[model samples]
Target: MFLRAKVRKKDGKEHRYFSVVENRRIGPKQQKRMAQRTVLYLGEINDGQEAAWRKSLEVFDESCQRYSTLSLFPEDREIPAEASSSIQVKLSEMELRRPRMFGNCWLGCELWRQLGLQAFWEEKLSSQVQRETVPWEKVLRLLVVNRLIEPGSEFRLHRQWFDPTAMAELLETDFAVAEKDRLYRCLDRILEHKQALFVHLRQRWQDLFAAPFDVLLYDLTSTYIEGEGEQIPQARYGYSRDQRFDCKQVVIALVITPEGFPLAYEVMDGNTSDKTT
Candidate 1:
């Protein structure tokens, strides 16, 4: 199925027309021939007419279980109401299911590409030759995208968020990429490449935005854990930024350029002083 365009000369001027067309293979296989059938004649559409058509477009909101008109143009743009394409849907026969988030996940993937994290991780965390069920880099991408989009724990992403969102479709993999153990394993593997990952991101920022690193800003913050944190060596009693002094915490320090590009970060013992850091 495609759009077919035709041109005709009238009054010494070429006029253009468009129609929805479908290509069909006609006759037997031994004498096969291609034929185009016009499904709908669109005639000549002007800008105003097109805007009107777009203004009349509707989309189904599965979450709300309702339909709303879609706007192709910005909210400030005025659409002409002189023409419209109306569609009739039978409410009784219609069913809506499997509502997956798409826009934010797509944007997350695009940002990941723009930062060159895909290739960087692919090289850093190369897939093993043991016939891995899913690429380690892709799994890492899923984790990063989950953080960027919803900012949830790996457990939540694996149990609740993965199936409901479009990450599976966007990442081109099945539920294996979001498996609970795989997420944790991917994190464990990337710890060794932390410094290299920071360098790669810094270079990407410089290349993409010409970001300057001359003026570096440093800051430290502490995040307290709810439990005793006995198993974690770094977790200790510290100055609580969140006013949770009773709980064990870890101090996180970060260095960034003036333009807000992160240069480096460190996770120190909770008892470490800011001045010492």
Candidate 2:
């Protein structure tokens, strides 16, 4: 890469404009060639110090090799340019925060966008109050992505997970959207459209995969509750999957496609058998 001075003869005056140019190599190794391209145009010589400008950019590029980012904003002309112009260039550095968590958040957000979950939530959520007050879809997607990457509860997400993550920058929103209660409320809103969401995702997956979603798969799981008769009737003692036969528990059945797209789910009594479910 190098700086180029373009000569412009306007009305018989020799005017020169500067541009940063780089050579791009393409094609097979045997047919490789350098193609010059303009990277940046530093228009006309307004200050008549084009030499100093070139020296500054060259020095800036050199500094990039040494430091990725500067810690704080500094006054212009902090570094002297040893060029043949009476121009003392001005430059300032801004501290850039690129958390390693950005890549994980970015992949999650892109997947959420590709699934059209954002648009779906915006359109399918039935409550007018929720649509106006909370970004139910965005929050829910964030929760899912965070769970996949970090595996934490809503409380952990709001209090700890949000702080070090690049979610704020990626979502272009502040801490209010990641509040604990707000994240939990997103679950309540989404459950209202659970069946519709499943159907929607199945169709979306079919379109994405470009194949028929054939073959149904069923799965059953059970979890026990530790509470002692807190007025919950469905909580019954059953053959515990975890061998906690004495504790109250509940059964859940999930129906999914061979492509791993969930179609429906059922929550049943604790003693419900796999055959009955």
Q: Which structure among the candidates has the greatest lDDT?
A: 1
**TM agreement with the true structure for every prediction:** 0.68, 0.62
In angstroms, give how far residue 63 of model 2 lies from its true place. Answer: 22
Q: 268, model 1: CA deviation in Å?
A: 0.3
lDDT to native, each model: 0.81, 0.74
lDDT of 1 by residue, 223-245 (tens): 89988888889999989999988
Error of 2 at 216 (Å): 1.2
What is the Cα-based TM-score of model 1? 0.68
lDDT of 1 at 45: 86
Best by TM-score: 1
What is candidate 2's lDDT per residue for 162-276, written digit by digit as tens?
8788887877777877988888777766777888888888878878876465578899999899877467677888889999988999898898877777778977889998887
Candidate 2 residues lying further than 4 Å off, grouped into runs, are 1-100, 129-133, 228-233
